[model samples]
Target chain A: MAKGTILSIDAMGGDAAPGVVVDGLAALLADRADISVLLHGNEPVLAPLVAAQKALAGRCQIIHSDTVITSDMKPSQALRRGKGSSMWNAVEAVKNGEAGAAVSAGNTGALMAISMLILRKMEGVHRPAMTALWPTLRGRTVVLDVGANLEADAAQLVTFAIMGEAYARAALGIAKPTIGILNIGSEEMKGHDEVREAHEWLRAAKLDIDYRGFVEGDDISKGAVDVVVTDGFTGNVALKAGEGVARMLGSRMREALTASLMTKIGAALAMAGLKTLRSQMDPSNVNGGVLLGLGGVSVKSHGGTDARGFARACELAADLASSHYRDEILANLARIREGGLAAE
Target chain B: MAKGTILSIDAMGGDAAPGVVVDGLAALLADRADISVLLHGNEPVLAPLVAAQKALAGRCQIIHSDTVITSDMKPSQALRRGKGSSMWNAVEAVKNGEAGAAVSAGNTGALMAISMLILRKMEGVHRPAMTALWPTLRGRTVVLDVGANLEADAAQLVTFAIMGEAYARAALGIAKPTIGILNIGSEEMKGHDEVREAHEWLRAAKLDIDYRGFVEGDDISKGAVDVVVTDGFTGNVALKAGEGVARMLGSRMREALTASLMTKIGAALAMAGLKTLRSQMDPSNVNGGVLLGLGGVSVKSHGGTDARGFARACELAADLASSHYRDEILANLARIREGGLAAE
Candidate 1:
């Protein structure tokens, strides 16, 4: 948003393509005057959309990319053939320092592969993790490695804790965020060997954040800790499961409030309150999945998200860029490495 | 409830102890006169509670035990020292064939250890899995390996699939339940090698169940599959996460509906519909975690559950036993083994 700062937009990535991208950018521009965008997509499609929105066109610089990554494309296939693609160019902008961050409503695998290949891993980082802002009763919690890697060792778990803590501080504005390792139980010896080892290391480590020993899956939504750390497999499953439950409950609630004539009247009266609750639980409100432990910030939005959701992803990228999340992560990683706290 | 069939009750287990157990038994007895129960606990604690309930006392036979398995006691410690504990005695009844099934509201790990040590694994079972009836949009779905073991190999997963299919047919009355492997993605190459291998095996296995390949966590509540199978770690986490989300959403809904006078009136008007929804979402309705792959039925009720919840658990145990779930699992396992479906 600041001078010489920009966020690259993958205009042709999502299901709705450049229209949603343009609309989302226009919506974002309505709120912030200083934010600039580098729009990457085919000029023929994007130019007309950009021209339609005067404010958005004034602030956005179109960067023509002939190729677009399909949602079904494999990561390996994308890697080999995605040169000059919209998703690729967007990530490249961040790596080349032309943009402070990149936001893409694209194929997640392809986006992750390109981000990793272009920005590379941060110093001393074993593996980068994908972090999502999970809505909780108290507020939002940062949950990590939500399908970045299937498994993580003790060292990688510890690294995730550090990165997640930094992310909470920068993105969520939680100073000295508390971190917890996700386990089957809160007991010290409850989970697998790697989890127990990470628990021991975190307990012994000297870190800025509060290290809560262990928490169960429910702790994520209960806001038991600011940062919830786990391997990608568990995190991914838990995230999706939580989402599924939320959806099921929501549908049930709606069905209940409209079951009869009297309930229909009640539903009308309760519209305001229901709206508030719906907004709180909306996925679009927390659309971005930030790829952490990388040299630059890159947010992967849901491929099926609409314009409003895509705007939220852009805002997440802008927030990370403005807060200098990468620098904070680097500082924290340096401390972790120097302390030799997460040695395998 | 059937003639010559009995359910072993751990009278000293659950948070509410003998009172809830007695009440639950009385409730069950009210509906069925044929079912009998063996109450295992300290004589002093059991006698008065049993004496207070005329129906329960008439149908129950006291089996005095000197010790009780405390909630905090480790599984190994309980296995070593809980020879005559109520929890241990209840499981022993099933093993001794004095009871058709065992129902306990005790520490899960201790119950699991006692059940495994006493009843023993069925022939050809690699590892027994814990199965749960998860509430879904369309009635209920069976999910397995919700924490019997932390890890499961390809062979074990295939075994779980067979066991889960049997449980669904018995408990849910589904003729051919659709089975799906819980993974991060539906793609064949999405998850770890074990998951992919199990997916391949299930696809090729000569089984009566409908194998639907891979399903993500969201599919659990979507009713996309009848049975969801995964390693204990992921399944446990996913189950808890789903529960947590339900709790959070429920609380939020209540808060929203009661925030204003208008909404309060609305809530009152929607009471009947709301009650229906609540019953559907209530965890107590599906209180038992059935331990499959053992020779006898063993249901682990929630320690914190009340009389009604415990009754539901007892009903689950009765259903499993009466339906001859063990024999069905054995036949399914034999078929799988004969087909060489899950050979390493």
Candidate 2:
């Protein structure tokens, strides 16, 4: 069993929160013996849900909070104003070391802002990058700055590369990940001035990363490289578009199968393969997004995640806590600083 | 018949060109008896491929050019050196009035650069935006500045919105296309300085475009809006990532189906449904990336297009030639310019 005693879960966050959060924690408690959960939300509202789940009665400790940060709140303002809110409390628990980790499905901007303000970044780390595993054709690739630092300098991009490589090693279990700079073209002379300058700096430097040259946008899922590094603005766009494509393809497949009698017949004949495809493409399995460079473990699940998806997020957080990712990242930063290579 | 006489095709461009080009032209010619093709490539190399198609024997004409512009060539060098290259010849043909439309599956930058230099922009248009239709859950959504102007200002984004809406009307058959700016958040206050300023400008302006509101990246394939406007860099990244996700999801589905014996049994049961899904996501159906705001009709296909994809590109080009897209874009540009909006 892992040594982590408690995990603070934001009950009032996400599109399908409270319910899914209760379901996930209840399911997790039945299996995980060492871990306990502190459900942060309205006490009166959540007590019934906990009482309904016999297995979760003693496993979860409810911390009643009246305020709930909705998805529409301005992240910076909400963090400053809504201190006693469920999302804020959950993150605060992790910050105070009262909880092993904190998980939220609330306003992403709010979560990011609150976390940054409460849990200051590690030494030598300028900004925290939101990293997620993008399921690719070859396998899965770790993409960083998915929606964290929108306006980043070349130094930030370099830091993103280092932190991304470390995250890949901790999360994905890849020892030596091949890193690629996401650019408009694969050629060395392509991209904007900043990208071009970064390319030269990375190529010239004796970095620990395996810089496998530049990669175009299409190469992200082709497994052409292991880690794709870019600023938050572009990374966020790519991530969202990727999600859109997955949803589009899935819906189109369903529509095509139900288009006509012949297609329906074809759909029936191909049920085996179709089921396999559906399960593979389902967002539930890959629901967690890691907030890398944070002082503690925090994951952001999908807004509309169901019970299974919520369970997956908790499961992911448990794995991350066990891996000691925070410690590793700090150690990496220390090493970079000691080597006199830390970004100024 | 569509009345357009000559169509210039880059015979030596694309992965399976010459063969694909001839096959596409032959198939198109069979349907439209009035159109003639000006095939650009090495005459000796393309002769046999042309000979293989009986309908293309003497019905099509060849503009012999030994030089070729590769997909990897720099835009400036390609434009400077590639005088008789396939893409160059195709654009030249359009400029010289030898062809009503030009289609190529070569370097996008080269095509854009050559088109800008040779045929030039339409009246009152400063820059041309490349637009492509993304297959979405709601339907097909037009995304513009797919890689045209990398560092676009507020006015350029407005131009994209105007041009994209016009393209949507001409191509997707939408009467009053709902136009939305792609931002990090959907709120009016979201995004960078450029987006914020543009939002205000678009909101205050009186134009034919149905300015819906701000949209996030995921909204592209959700069909939330008819036209998704973004700068070239963001648009390109989003477009490619979408493609990557579709390809990635398909591969993951295949892997899942072939994982084990029980899964294989499940796969066998659902084979027909799977085929239908694959057909829907197939890239062949969506081939053309139309270069909007250009003086003449020009379509850019994938650098690695097959025969069916090439044929789709030609079909899209032909369709554009028959539409009033050119005049509509010109009028729209005039409207925006008359409103006294600066480029920045």
Give the top-scoring candidate (TM-score): 1
**Candidate 1 chain B worst ten-residue window by lDDT:** B184-193
What DockQ do the predictions score, one after another? 0.65, 0.44
Give the per-residue lDDT digits (tens) of candidate 2, residues B1-344. Answer: 13456788998888777777788888878777677788899999988888788777666787899799987788888978999888899889989888888999888878888888888888767778888888877668899888876767787788788888888887788899999998885232367777777788788777877898788888888989999998878888889888877777777766765766656664555556667667656677777898888789888888777777787788778777678988887787777777887463
lDDT for each residue of candidate 1 in A271-330, tens digit (9 for 90 to 100): 878888998888988889998988888998888887889989998888888886667667
The C-alpha TM-scores of every prediction are 0.96, 0.91
Candidate 1 local lDDT, B269-335, one digit each (tens): 8787889899888888888999898878899999999898999999888878889666777787777
Candidate 1 at residue A182, lDDT?
A: 92
What shift in Å separates residue B234 of candidate 1 from its native position after superposition? 0.8
Candidate number achieving the greatest DockQ relative to the actual structure:
1
lDDT of 2 by residue, A138-227 (tens): 667889888786666776777777788877776777888888888885233367776666677667666667888778788998989888
